[model samples]
Target: MLTFYSEGSRLRQARTELHDGALVTPFECPERLDLVLKQLRQSGLGEIRTPNAYGLAPVQAVHDKDYVTFLANCWTEWVSAGHKGEAIPNIWPARTLRGDRIPRAISGQLGYYALAAETSISEGTFEAAMASKDVALGAVEHTLKTGEPSFGLCRPPGHHAAYDQFGGYCFFNNAAIAAQRALDSGMGRVAILDVDFHHGNGTQQIFYQRDDVLFISLHGDPEVTFPYYSGYADEHGQGQGEGFNVNYPMPPGTSVATWMAALDQALARIHAAKCECLIVSLGVDIFVDDPISEFTFSSEDFTLLGKRLAHAGLPSVFLMEGGYAVEAIGVNVVNVLQGFKQSME
Candidate 1:
């Protein structure tokens, strides 16, 4: 598999994350990518290359234009407001609140566009987020050009972002953007299989009403997980996209067999859809040791997971989402890629 990455991705480091009603150092930090790169080199899979510049057009395909503008300017606006220390949203438009109205204050805008308070916008957030989008787009291009699977090692993971809202350390929905790019590039249909530990609320919402892309996610049950508002099986899509959205929500401490069972079902759905392209929202946070995620998947299980995905035989693009087990993250991620490579033979 080819790997796409960028050093600029390290710039979106947030100084603080609002967790459990308190500020703490973020779990999604720059070092996560370092270990992934180290393991990629050690595995001898492929060289990590800088991504191609796809620009804002591809990114805007999946994200809201005004929201994209907000992301690009929020950091600067925050700085100009004379308030320091990474911009974290303190307020949100809850039920009964007016969401249609855009706030003029930078502080209010931060809250308005943010899905949650945990994702803080640091100085270089917009730049790093754009670089991450490039990584995803470049990986898609690699898959298209080489006729082989490609991996986008995206940072500040993007599963919890929505069309206009950003959260869960994600400023832009990289996986959704990649899927859209596939469709825009003339692919008949695209299927996104998100195996991230947390539900890809953002990706699901991006295509919930569109039939061109099918979004399936296997993640921790939203009933007791982070971003606890979405991810139920009932959110099967709306309008022309009905039945295109699939969600497999498992309880915490879910066993590997159970997880794989869900994977098989998701794969079957992808096969049934007859998707022309595949995008895996690859996240290793389901590992037993992941700090913020729960699931009993051992490192070796990732290999099997990858092998099964490879069995599908679709041209695939893997986009990194969330995996905070910093020490073992590299080995786990490489295991999946290596497994897929071996399976392709």
Candidate 2:
């Protein structure tokens, strides 16, 4: 497995995250990538390559132009507006409120583009986001060209970002962008299997209305999870995308056996869809000791998950998503990659 990464990912050093009505240090910090890189090297998984610059075109392919513009200039605007602390949305266009208008004030604009208030924008956030998408794109290119598996160690993970909103510590939808790039590169059909602890709401929304890309996610039940709005079983794709989107929302403390069963179902659906490429929104937060998520997956289970995906026998790209257990993150992620490598042999 070839892994794509960027030192620019360390630029996003936001210090604030809203949790339980109080501001605390963010769980999605730069060290998450550091630890993962360390483990990848120590485990001798494969070559670690720095990603090439793909610029905003790939990002604009999956995200709205205005949203991309907002993310690029948000930090400068917030600072010029003289607001104190990192930029976090204090208000949002809730139910019955006008969401059509883009606000002029930085604060109002933050609310306009934000899906949740947990993520704060700091200096270099835009740069880091750009690099993160580049990493994903690089991995996609590698997989498509070589017909092999690759990993994108994306930081400030992106599954939670929607078409025009940034939240859940994600500024840009990296996995969605990678999938779009794969499609643009002439693949007939692509499937995204999100095994993250949280549902890939942004990736779902990006491809929800298209049949060319099948989106499937297994996550905590939205009723009790962080992103409480989406991720239900019934929120299937709309229009031409009907029957292409699948969600398996399990309860808290879901056993590894049950989770593997869900993976089997998702793999079966992908095989039926005849997808030419596979993208895994790899998140190890399902680990038993993760603080934010509730699941009971052991480190060894990740190896089995990787083996199962390898058996699918499609060109694969694994994009890093949510995982807070900093110490074990590397082990779990590398376990998956190593398992896939061993299985392929």
- Among these predicted structures, which one has the highest lDDT? 2
Question: What C-alpha lDDT does candidate 2 achieve relative to the native structure?
Answer: 0.93
Segments of candidate 1 deviating more than 4 angstroms: none
lDDT, residue 114, model 1: 88
Evaluate residue 214 in candidate 2 and report its C-alpha lDDT on the 0 to 100 scale: 95
> Candidate 1, residues 38-92: lDDT per residue as tens digits?
9999899987899878789987787889999999898889889998688988888
The per-residue C-alpha lDDT of model 1 at residue 63 equals 80
Query: Relative to the unseen true structure, what is the C-alpha lDDT of residue 239 in candidate 2, on a scale of 0 to 100?
Result: 99
Task: Show model 2 residue runs off by greater than 4 Å.
Answer: none
lDDT of each: 0.89, 0.93
Candidate 2 C-alpha error for residue 138, in Å: 0.6
TM-score, prediction 1: 0.98
Return the lDDT, model 1, position 189: 85
Model 2, residue 98: what's the lDDT? 92
Most accurate candidate by TM-score: 2
Candidate 1: C-alpha lDDT: 0.89
